[model samples]
Target: MPLLAGAATVVAVVGAVLALADVDSPLRGPFTLFFLLAAPSVAIAAALRGLDPFGRLLASVAGAITVDMLVAQGMLAVHRWSVRGGIAAVTALSSVLLLLVVVRRLRGRTASRRTS
Candidate 1:
């Protein structure tokens, strides 16, 4: 599990770096797409711990797509659309969601320990 997570993190970072740097490598597109999909999916899936695996996967993927679309639409609406901006916004949003899940889990553990 840890290895899989490490691999995903590496892929995501590489994708973001490639996009931000304006690199023209063949890997830029596919890796960026994977980063866009995987980041939010993982963050949302982390939050939804009670659901069955298949259901969680489905929901998280759907949520990830929704997040991506919403980010694009928002940027377009503001007339500030750019690839770097979009990637940065998505990364920040995903990080926030992941942080929330981590905080919630830690709070739950501490509260349970107090009760015990």
Candidate 2:
């Protein structure tokens, strides 16, 4: 799972670079889609970390798609639909979600240590 996350992150970074550079490469479209979806998927996985493997996969995919659509609609509302905006929105939301996951995990550990 970590390997999958890492690969997705790498692809996302590459996609962001391609988008920011405004490259005319053939791979740009697919890579951009990867970038848009990858971070949210990772974040969803983090949020559902306690779930079983199959449940986690299903939840992550659904959550990622939901996040993507919300971001897209938000961009459309502001009339700023661009690759950079898409990437930024995904990255920001994912960061927040992952941060929440870390905070929750840390609090859980601290509570356990206290109880012990």
Candidate with the greatest TM-score versus the true structure: 1
Which runs in model 1 stand beyond 4 Å of their true positions?
none
lDDT of each: 0.96, 0.86
Question: Mind giving the per-residue lDDT tens digits that candidate 2 earns over 1-116?
Answer: 99986887787888878988999998888888887777788788988878999999888988899999999999999999987778788889999999999999999999999999
* Shift in Å, residue 30, candidate 1: 0.3
Cα lDDT of model 1 by residue, 51-101, tens digit: 999999999999999999999999999999999999999999999999999
- Candidate 2 lands at a TM-score of 0.87
For each candidate in turn, the TM-score is 0.95, 0.87
Q: What is the lDDT of residue 89 in candidate 1?
A: 97
lDDT of 2 at 65: 94
Which runs of model 2 end up more than 4 angstroms from their true locations? 1-5
Task: Rate residue 68 of model 2 by lDDT.
Answer: 91
In lDDT terms, which candidate is top? 1
